[model samples]
Target: MKPLDPRLLRRARGARVFLAASVLIGVASGVLIVVQAVLLAHGITGVVLRGSGVSGVALGLALVVAGRALLVWAQEVVAQRAAAAVKSTLRRQVLEHSLKLGPVWLSGERSSALTTLLTKGLDDLDPYFARYLPQLVLASTVPAGVIGWMATGDLIAAGTVLVTLPLIPIFMALIGWATQARSRRRQHALAVLAHHFADVVGGLTTLKLFGRAKAQESAVRRVTDQHRAASMGSLRLAFLSSFALELLASISVALVAVGVGLRLVDGKLGLETALMVLILAPEAYLPLRQVGLQFHASADGVAASEEVFRVLETPLPMRGDRTDVPDLRVSPLQLYDVTVRYTGRDEPALDGFDLELRPGEVVALTGPSGAGKSTALAVLLGFVEPERGVVVAGGSAADEFDPIEWRRQFAWVPQRPGLRLGSIADNVRLGRPTASDDEVRLALLTAGAGELALDKPVGEQGQLLSGGQQRRVALARALLTNAPVLLLDEPTAGLDPDAEAAVISGLRATGRTVLMVAHRPALIAAADRTVSVGARELVNA
Candidate 1:
């Protein structure tokens, strides 16, 4: 995990503006530090050493204090804005890149871990930008400003501050490096815990059926304990580091105070000059101490950003020029020697698979479990890319056209439908948002699901409906799209004889080119032609 990668600032224009504003605010705050310190010394000397009245300089001191307060408030505002811009930009970029990588890439990782990274992990970066970064700027500018002002009044006190200042950063660097390591460990622990919890919850029913639920309890507890220990270790290091920095700042300020007092007592320094040196000495160390404290607070965010940068740096998949494909309804859809191999697998999921679907014909793909039936559908839907072949519709290769526009011409229904919590009509509307009420009802009738009312509410994941009814609703959605091609992956799976008959009948009447994967004899019988996929070739079934 690198800290504050330059690519982050360069990629997000809004983040650059936020950082620029923070630096500008830090400069203004440094100017205020000098003015406020000098005015306070002047006012104190007038009443004590010069024997002048306090009322003369009272208004000037009050104005300077007010100006300092205003600057502090403005700095916080700028810091917050900068943090928001960076977080939002990073989140959007991560999501967009993940989408472009496609589901095959995402399915390899835990969904829970991805959720945690996008939500809480990126959110942790807030403190880094809003507090730690601004303090770092102040630490660089304010200390220099304060030390330079003191040198003009008392060179001895200025030299003492300059010498002791290096010690604070030296100690900070050693502690910060250790803390960063601990913070990274804690972040990793958190992601692992989240993934374990999510997996356990999703598989709880299976575990109970196997009488292994109790066994999972120990696994969960072990992970929870590890996360707790990591968190405690990070907190302990933060507290220890903060204490060390405070102690160093206090001792350095004390030395400057002692030296100034001796010089004034010896009559070598004027009362006003000694007072100014004493005031400016603490000011020089305050920014440095504050930066050390804030660094501890932002360690977790910095560690989390390391993962964010890793995801952002992932290379995107190659894409071709966006050209419109010719209409598929007038010509045939053909796969010529297509082959696909998944990551971390010895054999290709698809190997030299070839087939053709003519207009108005139903084609059924059949074979053993790993016969690449689903992979063929994926190739047509533009989800998976083949390493050694082309998918052609009409005359042009599908890869030459924009995948999104090409996919829009086809309707797809997976083996399992993902339904949201909504009314039946609302869920179907997702297929074609501009569909009218009559179109929705007609589509439902076309898919043999007209019995389900439009306004009927389906609970989460369509739990209210039977499995066959849910399949029908998914079919209705496919019909509602009014696409020229229909791609179904095991459409009649888990259906009773009556429900399966209704689905097969509806699919035959779709009046669109159909490409489906099926293992059942009844589904194969309904297709105009059946193509059986093997390890390396396609055979007529």
Candidate 2:
């Protein structure tokens, strides 16, 4: 990202306001700085060079100082608010765009990395907004104003500043190039550590079962150490860059002071003018030095913002603006010669796939594991756009209906249902939040989960329930929906014969149109008809 990425101002409203305010503050600060220096030089020259009282300059000096302090405080307040609003806006955009990209895109991404980016990663931007950016505005305004003021009094001092001012930024650019690389590496390390830790925790149970949990200690330690090293490396470089900037600025200020003092000694310049020039020289270099120092602090945030922008800029799949979807109960859902080819795969996931889902019929999609059974369901759910062909409903193309509205017509249960930390009733209520307790019980009973307690707590990802029980809960949730179509992805994959039979019974009881990805013989037998999905030629069983 550049010093001030225009994307931020375009995407976040707060940034535009912040920039305008910063400019005003920067200009005011510059004027106050020059005024303060002039007042101090006048007071000193009056008291030292001549018999004069302190009363004249005292009040004006105090007011100038107070005004400068107020500007600093105001800048701080504005920067903090801008940081918060920008982060909030970016986070919301990322989430909304992720949804538009759909599950297929997300399935290929690392959820842990994304979680870290949204949480810890973006938080690193606090320094960028609060300190670095405000200083950047000052750097642009204060130095120019200071030099221009000095020029009116002493051209030599102003010329020296003009000659050396570029050095600080030149050095900054060189060091910043290196710092940016390190910051990016540190950010990557943090993401990798987060991803690794989430994976370990997610698979901790299996690791313990295999007596390999203890063995993972070394791996975790290694990743943690890498993150630590990267962090320390970034900090060390930041310190070195700060030291270098300070050294360069100090040298530049000293040069101006030496020239001013020599000219004053020769009686070639007045004491008051010499003192004012001397004071303003350091002031000119101060903002530039601060910019160089704060750049290091904000590097991580700049790197993270790049990642956020990448996600925000991703093109959403083309969806229809129309909301008038055909009634599923009357109009058949048809996928005619639909072909879906995922990235990096030579063969299409589903090629020349044709299926028609009529009203109130349970159709089973059965084929080998890699045969795109789930992909077919994904297409129906509007999660994946077919590379070729279109899904037609009531003589209107599926793309003609708004994606969200089209999805609302179907109740979908993935192979692994995502259940949050809640009771069984709470999870089921997600399908229909306004459902009464009796309706919940009826749905659970129909899905063969009547034996399970409604108040039973399901841990994160439904860990508290067994695989079969989780599937039943998911099915019950689906059963509670008012959607006309129920799309189940192997709803009874791990169930015993009795449990499978109960699920089949539940399907028969629900009069909704059904499409299921089935592998087991029992589920296929239960379906009204089975269609094999792998081959180009559709085989009905």
- What is the Cα-based lDDT of residue 109 in candidate 1? 63
Candidate 2 Cα errors over 4 Å, as ranges: none
Number of the predicted model whose lDDT against the real structure is largest = 2
407-488 per-residue lDDT for model 1 (tens digits): 7789899888878999999999999999999999988887778889999998888988887778889989998888889999
lDDT of 2 at 159: 98
Stretches > 4 Å off in candidate 1 = 1-3, 11-13, 203-218, 258-268, 321-323
The CA lDDT at 91 in model 2 is 96
In model 2, the number of clashes is 0
User: Residue 502 of candidate 2: its Cα lDDT?
Assistant: 90
Per-residue CA lDDT of model 2 for 461-515, tens digit only, reads 9999999999999999998987899999999988999989998998998888999
**Local accuracy by lDDT, each model:** 0.84, 0.92
Error of 2 at 101 (Å): 1.7
